[model samples]
Target: MKTIKSNFNAQGLVRIDSDDLKLEIKFESSQIYLNVISVNPRNLKTFFNLSDLRKLVIDVADKLAFWKFDLTVTWEGDELAYLGQHANPNILQKFIVAKNVEIKNLKGFAKLLGGRST
Candidate 1:
């Protein structure tokens, strides 16, 4: 797995992008929900909001530790049944690291995550 970029925005939005997927998390005030999910497979674009956004990420990272796992994410190449969210980070626009997952890098950005950076 590879680490692309992890960033935090002014409005308190934290975005994490891997070769296979780009996830934007909005777990701050006003919108206490994880609304955006983009995976490697173009077909999975319509399959966002799978579960707890944080848990989903943590799961994906956890799966990376295993070389041979049954569930493979499109970004994974995707995996995350989502056990649950973190127990902390209840503050506004605060991003706490629950777990870190290393995503394998793809050849190109547009083809990897199916979206190119602007």
Candidate 2:
């Protein structure tokens, strides 16, 4: 397993990579946590809102029978944060792109999760 970590400011963006799947989350407002998931990495389009992302993840967990985990998203002041403890890359990618939004920078965008600049 691989790990990625970075600090995010208000409305800041942070991404994580596990195998072929990528996770992109943007800090929308300090009042609430917001994230936009995408498949193929480059689209950076948001298909699932917080509730949507949770439901989809639950459905996938039930279908795949992978280890059950909880995802907590929070934003306080100038901080945007996310915690996803999962093991299914396929499900993750699927959930991210489930809504079918167009990605802007395929290669460039996914890279942002690990080491690309916004």
Candidate 3:
């Protein structure tokens, strides 16, 4: 287990920077909600909903099960939505099990987490 140093500011924002990944999450109210500000390698920043990311992963897993590929998303924006800094492998495993994907390489499937493409 690694320690995540989360930085909080006066404007209700939390930042996490590790190696080559930068994550800026913002909190608006007291309802325990946060919006991802930027999760990228460099020169590229983006924001996306967590729920949307899970859906995209599940969709990709489905397509992978059907077509057999690492990344086949055509839409460019869809690529951005799938990448997130805080996406744990446990989450992926849960989605894979829930989606009934009989794939073991589902872990570390997000090769785009640090903006790597193949």
Can you write out model 2's per-residue Cα lDDT over 4-100, one digit (the tens) per residue? 4443335666786754444555554322233334334333225435466556645644432222222333222222222233332345455664322
Candidate 3: pairs in clash: none
List where candidate 2 sits over 4 angstroms from the true fold.
1-45, 66-118
Clashing pairs in 2: 42-105, 42-106, 43-103, 43-104
lDDT of 2: 0.39
Predicted candidate 1, C-alpha RMSD: 15.6
Model 3, 3-106: lDDT tens per residue? 45433322365666765445454443311122333345332324445466656556655543343223222122232222222223356655544332332233
- Alpha-carbon runs more than 4 Å astray in model 3: 1-46, 70-97, 100-118
TM-scores of all candidate predictions against the true structure: 0.25, 0.22, 0.27
Write one digit per residue (lDDT tens) for candidate 1, span 1-118: 9855433222366677777557665443322223235555665556644345446666654443332222222333232222122222233313443333322222332344345635
lDDT of each: 0.39, 0.39, 0.38
Best by TM-score: 3
Superposed by TM-score, candidate 3 places the C-alpha of residue 62 at a distance from the truth, in angstroms, of 0.5
**Order of the predicted models by TM-score, top scorer first:** 3, 1, 2
